[model samples]
Target: MEENNLIKKCQRGDKEAFQKLISQYHPIVHKFLVKITNHEQTAEDLTQETFLKIIRNIEKFDIEGKAKFSTYVITIAKNAYIDYLRREKRAMQNTPIPENLNIEDVHIQVEETVVNKLYGQSILENLEGLSEEQKIAIKLKYIEGLTLKEIGDQLNLETKTVKSRIHNGIVRLRKQLEKGDER
Candidate 1:
């Protein structure tokens, strides 16, 4: 069956269609979650949660929108991972830190921030030479975690145009990084 037909059937509460859809998109969601979480078990659990959310709320999906099904699913997976992080943070905050751990031991946190800032600064410097469109596309796709269609909508451009800009921007960044390495 066509994807649209499958989606329609799933939306109508057809369990078989929903299962097929989940099977089709599960790997994509799992891979994306793994990238974000860096843990196989967490990614697997999140992937299942994403599909569950989709199954429960499939009626909310807009079939005629510019966003593709995969994009929508990926967005859900990203949001799910973010929610997990927030929950983890809240849990950590509620738990008391051990008295054996001194304030001096927390220097690792400051060092991590400094390292992140240095990398961020380097990336910003490399991005300076890119065209405005390229820069915006790259930032929206990677930093802001927006889909290509979402970025296109924001920039009033086509999806292909946004994708091209991101591709060109990445190439330029790679060349810049290589030059920096050589220096």
Candidate 2:
């Protein structure tokens, strides 16, 4: 297969092969990063980091009987995004509170946390009625903001399947919400 040949060439340190691979998957990975980070610059930076990791660990990549190369690369991208989030969380937590900061800032943070918690709980309660696949598709597409193709890559489904799952899941959620409103 062409993918197998590319993987072999990449493992053998063929920069052209590696470049080809990156060019092919960069959009998918960058789209995924944008969903996670919600910032174009951060997503771009993370995209580069993901490829660097892939280049460094190409030899460890198993092309046959393991996983598709796209899936493997997406996994790497997701892990990199998660690591970035964790680092950001830690940085925020370690940031010192300025003595001159207004009380309104603290109050705003508290309010935001409360709103997020309530919104998250409402979504989770509604999701309880969905099948696992539906729930995952909805979460990845709506909550994570991944495109259909990116979701397909992550879930190992075709883009059409991902679109169907997301559409059906949204319909179900809408019905559930309407029923709740009737009560």
Best by lDDT: 2
Residue pairs with backbone atoms closer than 3 Å in model 1 (clashes): none
- Residue 94, model 2: lDDT of 100
The TM-score of candidate 2 is: 0.64
Clashing pairs for model 2 are none
The digit string of per-residue lDDT tens for model 1 on 73-146 reads 87788678778877987998999978899777689876775586567666776775776557656766786588
RMSD of 1: 7.9
Q: How do the predictions measure up, each by TM-score?
A: 0.58, 0.64
Residue 176 miss distance in model 2 (angstroms): 17
Worst 10 residues of 1 by lDDT: 30-39
**lDDT of model 2 at position 119:** 75
Question: Model 2: runs farther than 4 Å from truth?
Answer: 104-139, 143-183
lDDT of each residue in 156-176, candidate 2, tens digit only? 789999888888888998898
